[model samples]
Target chain A: MQYGFFQVLRQVELAPEHFVIWGRLTPPPHQPILPGSFLHLKVDPPGDYRMLWRPYSFLDYQPDTHQAAIYYRVVGEGTGQLCQRREGELLPAIYPLGTPFTHEGVSRAIMVAGGVGVAPLLMLYDRMRHSSPQLRVEFLFGARSGRDLVPGLLEEFGVVARMASEDGTLGHRGYITDLLPEVLEQGEWQMVYACGPNPMLSALADLLPEGLPCQVSLELPMACAIGVCNGCNLPLRSDGGRYPRRLCVEGPVMDLREVDFAALV
Target chain B: MGGSSAAQTAEGFSLEVSLGPLRLSSPLIGASGCVAFGEEYRRLYENSRQAMEGSSIAQLGAIVTKAVSLKPRGGNPPPRVAETPAGLLNSIGLQNPGLDHFLAELAPRLSQLGTKVIVNLVGDTAQEFAELASILSQKTDFPAFELDLSCPNVEEGGRSFAMSLPSLREVISRVRQVTDRFLIAKLAPNVCDIGEFAQAAVEAGADALTVANTWIGMVVDVERRTSRIGRTTGGVSGPAIRPLTMALVHRVRQAVRVPILASGGAVRTQDVLEYLIVGASAVQIGTGLWIDPMCPLKINRGLREYLARHRMSLGELIGSFQAEVSRGG
Candidate 1:
């Protein structure tokens, strides 16, 4: 983990209330920036809003040049304030936090994302593409409506893309689950990765083929993004045993089957 | 950030604290639950700029592990924590990996950390408490045991043992027989007289006392028309309960001779200094640590400045607060 102030090179409005914050972060020497990891942005809310810094996922990172970016949505006062910052501002951050998504010797993988949840998966795809260019990959991106979809980052990724929107303005006219079944039927995917709001992740977890392996990035209201807080707990179950796992260290990305979806709101 | 600082004071005063056989480099501890036994925060410390600044987790006096038990507890169901004004209501329910898993997996790494380890133990019965103590007594690495008496006394119809004199004595006495290590009985603050509970545990051979645990609190999400926590009520911690706990520390100081390890709402160095003034030999940082992993380091830095500014030693401040100040004419 690295704690330092990174200069904001640019901030792009991905969609309504959504943004991709680009920071000039060059890690120390020989440090590997992994996928599904996050950085805590200490956005000092101007007034008495009661929130400290907040956590956002690494949208994409370049190892050679050592540049990193974070994706965020204006959910509350904390994040809403962060989106208002201009470029060239120094943003304090704690980086490469939580566990990363690993390729686990799979020849093929499927990714399911909802809105800003697509952030980490993009980085995962970006990094994995280097090692396994021929590795078959499919991306299922979803949003509330047409205006909310990120413009063209998907087309530039150069992979099979499947899109969905609830308002029916985008690719498939329904929830992401509407497209998941057909995507599952398309190939013998070795692994599945998902990230999004709680209900969406839960629905995807429930919709997956039982025997297939899947990983999910869990989100909980947080304070200190570090493991010390014990605040963000995702109750999990595997092999009939149920327990709570802190998202900070154990995972932000966890096995989909292990998550006890019913345990969280 | 500074060339001149309190942590750099060169004088006769020292921040070190000694309570029975356990010695602490400073009075602040990484309260259980907020900090993992030690390893996780150690990584955070290592990653932090404080490492280059010449500060580390080693500066903390000790660490109390989250409540461990004889059997593994999965913890409370959904919504284990709820945020209140400058505090939180938590119902973690002492979730742990059980004795065998802890000793085999986490204990080895925890002992290796260059800080004192005070294992917090919780059980349903006095015998259960003693069994944990007996088991831990054999572990040479751990220097102390903190009895989490906030748990329900199943032997006495579900009221917390810390709330009843007899139950408190029975549990403390039973654990005392098995462990020669420093025994700290953590009492609760909700009862009518916290001092009475403090005295009872000491009489039963408690080496020290953790002044009080979280206060009983309930927060309702009125719009949703439901309890905030999955458990209807949970323990309230942070600045909300600091004053109430400070008073309890003062009362416990007057009632007993054992050192008091103050818990509950402590977020700042002033809170720690105040607790020491009210007779706490040490202070534990819980909800605050959850808010920031670097709290102990920040507080210690502030404490060194405080000691230097006042030109006083920590021992001079212990129980030094004069509640009834005389007005000079």
Candidate 2:
């Protein structure tokens, strides 16, 4: 990980509530942006110095140009401040942090996303398609409404996502997990990669076929994005016999089997 | 921005200050629990060119490790932190790898950091505190111990130890008997009169006092209608607490003759200066490290610039507040 400034190249409104900021790293990222890795951007004004660091997943990255896009929803103050940043503004950030998803020994995998959780999966999908041409990747994205879905952004990457919305204004009326049973029946899946709200992830974990491996990107409230503060903890399964993992380092991405979903409640 | 009569060069600048018999190269220190055992901060500093360009962790005077206990602690449950206006509320519940692990794994690594390491000890009882000092004194050459009598998150002995004079004195005195090294009693900010605790600590043989720890505060999720933190309430830290903690430092300085190591929401050079002018010998950076791990270097640079502009050395600036001019109330 490296601490440096990223000059804002552009800010685009992907949807009504969702926004994406494309920034060019000054010193550039020391390490390549792995699938699950993220950037902790200081969103508070320069002089405020309140340490309002909010971690955002990379929506896309151009290694040659040293530019990347961070997709986020204006949920709270941190993201609320981030969305207002204009082009040419320099924002302080730490990049390529947290353990990346383990994509080894996977030929065919299903990518599940809930709302803004689609951010990291886009990066992962691009990676898999480029590295292994024969690999088959399916994208199942769910949101609160049709307007919240970013099929336009997905199309830019040459992906056509099977969308789901709770309001029935989009593809399935109920939830994305509802389609998993039929999606699993279509082919033999090697791995499941997911990122989303806790309730959705818990439901996905329950719906998964037994012995199927799943990698999930978890979110927790964090003070220091580095490991020292011990603020963001990813509780381990009760039977796992391990201490709680610090999300800043150990993961933002973890195996669904190892995590204790019940304890998270 | 302002012209200076005596602008000192980097070579001529001195960030050194003394905390009683112990001397520090710089008055800035990494507060306990914030920097962990120094390894993580060291790694971040050494790796980042931005951090290295200005200064390194070596520029800091010393670092206080996270609280060490006799046995391992599981710590608090999830949702352990919440953000406030200009601060953070955390209930880590003193999660540590126990004393044996600290000595074996952490202590050896600390010695290589090129900075003084002051062990922060917390215990359920006075005997536990003494035993921690006894074991650490026998095993490591660490120069000082900051008795953490005011960890607000813990339910049992930790929360109330610093509030009550008898327990605070007993812990400090027991640790004093075990080691002659510099002992700093870290008091709680949630107190009736901080001066009383400061006086008791010195009378019981503390060489210095860390003005205060984080004050108890809480945050709630309106949607969930539940506490944001795991334990419902946690220690509130950052710039929000600086004014209150600075007042405590001023009170403690007046109550005791020992040197005071001020720990609060010191994020900038001016914050450090405020503590020093208020009569603190040194300042500790806790949440500031979260803001910028390299803040010490920036503060160190700012200190030199300020001193040069004023044509005053660090020694002259310390305890220079003119409270005597104030009329009696």
Candidate 3:
């Protein structure tokens, strides 16, 4: 974990209420941010002294330039303040937090994303592409509409994703689950990586092929990503334990089978 | 002010405070549940290189651990917290890894850290509270224990022990008999006449009193027609409760002869000073850490600068509130 001022380098509007922010770390992280790790950015101003910290997974990170990008969909007051920030302004943040994805022995994997949930999975794919040249990686991304699709980022990643949108403006019409059966048949997949809305992730948990290992990045609301405030709890299966695990520390990435989807309320 | 002592540094400034029998190097304390056995903050400090100027845990007077119960509690279900206007509402329900786990796994690491660690205890009955205190006192050489009297008493029809004077007296006196170590009674803020409770706590053998715990509050999700937190109501803490708690500290001070450890909303150095001026022996930073983990460091530095600028000792600043009388009333 590292805390420093990150100056805004650029901000791109991916869609209405969706954005990609690039910031330069004043004091670069001690270690490169690993795939599935996130930065806890304080969106509220410094003068106010009332901290409003939000955790955002890395969309992309540059170790040399000390530059990092994060994708956010404006949802509340914290994200609202983040969107209005401009270039050259610095954001106070704690970096490389939470447990990252563990893809040690994997040779083939499919990355499934819903909306801006594509952020962390992109990082994991980048890691796999660099570390294991022989790895076969594919992406199945879905959004609400064509405007919500991040074509620029996908192009930058050099990924031609099998896409889906609810309104039929993109690749496949309806939910990503509609295309999952076909995608599962196409690849002799060793593992699955998914990130998206809880409802979508919950559905994916039920739909995945049995015995297929999967890691999911959760989107639970959190305060003090350091694990003190027991706010962001990930409910686990009854057999796992009676207590819920803290998503900030225990996960933002967890085994799909371990989470209790029905008990998430 | 039984053990309160101040040693002036070469710069002629001091941050030391005494809470009855206990003494500390600095006046700032990490409240219960905020530091959580000190491991998380220790990891952060080690990773961040202790970045902020003097924000090390070593600089704090003490840290109150999360509530330790007789059995491990699962806590509330999902959505344990909600952000309000400058405050946070939480229903964590005192989730802790029971006494045996705490003493074996968590307690050992606490002594390794330079700061003083105060265990926060919660139980269903007065005897249960005593049992926890007795075991901890024998097992660990920790400086003190803070009683979390806000828990509902099963023996007394589920009413909070802190709400009724008899229940409050029974719990404190029971624990007081079992241990000679310093004891702090944490008062619940929801009751009427908070000052009266403070007096009852002190009379029942509490060495000091943590002015109050989080205020009871609720936040509704209008769209879903349900509570934002897992529980119907949650404890509220942060800047929104700072003013309210500071007043509680003053009121408690008025009614008690023992030291007062102020706990509620203390995010800034100014907030700490306000609590001290209103008669707090020391200030505990709770949700303030969520805002800035280095707050203890920042507040410590800020306090030093403020004291140096004023050329006053910490003892002089505490309970220094001056009232402006209005004759018309």
Candidate 4:
């Protein structure tokens, strides 16, 4: 984990209750930043109201600018205060935290995201793009309704994009699960990655055909995202045996076959 | 009280202690459920300059990792934690990677750190507990196994194993047969008579005791009309639980001859000293680490200064409190 003090270079609202924060952090000597890693950041501590470390997924990073981007949804008071933080405000954050989704040696893959679960997928998509052109990728983005959806987010990734909204606000009117079978039918998917709330990921885990490798990113209230506090844990699927893995350490993303959907959510 | 000798005063006070079979370089071990298997905290310690300066992380005598079981356990559902006034209520359901993987991929890494690795184990039955201990006995590297009977997170065996005397004896006796390494029975503070349970653990062949685990606690969100923590209840640990746990540890020390490791509400050096004064051989830093990852070092600094000032080692401070009808009144 790379721990350092970073300055808030930029912050903006992406959608209702969702925002992106950009910070310039220098990795501690001998440590390298990896994709899919997270930042255990501290919200401003005001008086006796001590704050706990909040985990943010790595949205995207630019080595040239020495800045990393994080996407967060205002779930609580800590995040609510973060959205109001001004530019040049600084906070301490631990970088390259938790496990990253591995996208190695795959020629074809599809990603499914729900709401702000799109946080980590954006960086994973960038890596997939920089990889050999032989690798074909498809992006499927979904939300509760049109207002919750980011217009033209799929276009920036330059991949074959599809969309679905629960209220028929934008694309096909249904959950992302309804759109999956058709995507898997069009091409032989070597890998599948999903990130968002548990229900969305669980539904995707249910739909993905057997033998298809699916990795899901979990979102939970993590106090010490470095694994010390057992706040964020994911139960492994039926085949994954009985132990629950800590999301802060072992994963934020794990194979869908291993996540015990019924046990966790 | 004896006067401090000049020679004794000149020497650097040691934080060393012998908890029966285990000898620690410092009386500071990361509490179970708070410390991870390895790498997660170490990488954070190594990468942060502030956490590395002046004092080192090695001062952490050991780490008692989150509980592991014979088979993997899918912990309770989300909303696992609720922030209390100065404490945290958590029902993280003994979430672990199971025994086989811990032995194969994890235990080896624990030894790489310059501290003891005390693996915590739990089970639904005595046979399962024995199987877990048997597997770890062969590893040779892990110095101890903490039989966790105080967790309030699970649903199957809702009542704690240590809550009843017979069950505590039965589980400890069975697991004792499998491993010769130091066996520490981690009991609960919620028991009706903690002293009786302490004697029960000692009689069952526990070499040492962790006095104790988090107290069962709950918080309700009036506006939401739901319990703050998922699973409705959790074990509370933090500054809020400190005094109550100190009393428990003090009582357990008086009842049992075995060394005691204090688990709850250890946030600063003064808290560590207080536990030691009341007869805790060591103190486990729990939820405090979440507030500041460098808590151990900061506490170690506070402890060292206190030791140097009084020219007393940790041993001298342990069980220093006297009980009497009058203080020479």
lDDT of 2 by residue, B72-183 (tens): 7778888888888889899998888899999889899898986788999988889999999999999998889999999898876445689899988899999999998889
Candidate 3 per-residue lDDT, tens place, B24-46, comes to 88888889988888877876765
Report chain A TM-scores, every model: 0.91, 0.96, 0.94, 0.91
What TM-score does prediction 2 earn?
0.96
Model 3: what TM-score?
A: 0.95
TM-score versus the correct structure, for each prediction = 0.87, 0.96, 0.95, 0.77
Candidate numbers sorted by TM-score from highest down: 2, 3, 1, 4
lDDT of 1 by residue, A67-158 (tens): 88777778776677788777877665667788989885766899988888888888888777888867788888888886666765665456
The interface root mean square deviation of candidate 1 comes to: 3.5
What is the lDDT, from 0 to 100, of the residue B226 in candidate 4? 83
Against the true structure, whose DockQ is highest? 3
Q: lDDT (CA) for every model shown?
A: 0.78, 0.85, 0.83, 0.78
Model 1 Cα lDDT, one tens digit per residue, B126-201: 9999999898788645888899997421223757888889989999999998878889999988788887888889
Better structure of 3 and 4 per lDDT: 3
Q: What is the C-alpha RMSD of each candidate to the true structure, in Å?
A: 3.8, 3.3, 3.4, 6.0
Candidate 4 chain B, poorest ten consecutive residues by summed lDDT? B1-10
Name the weakest run of 10 consecutive residues (lDDT summed) in model 1 chain B: B1-10
lDDT of 3 by residue, A171-211 (tens): 99988878888888887999999998888888898899898
What docking class should model 4 receive? acceptable
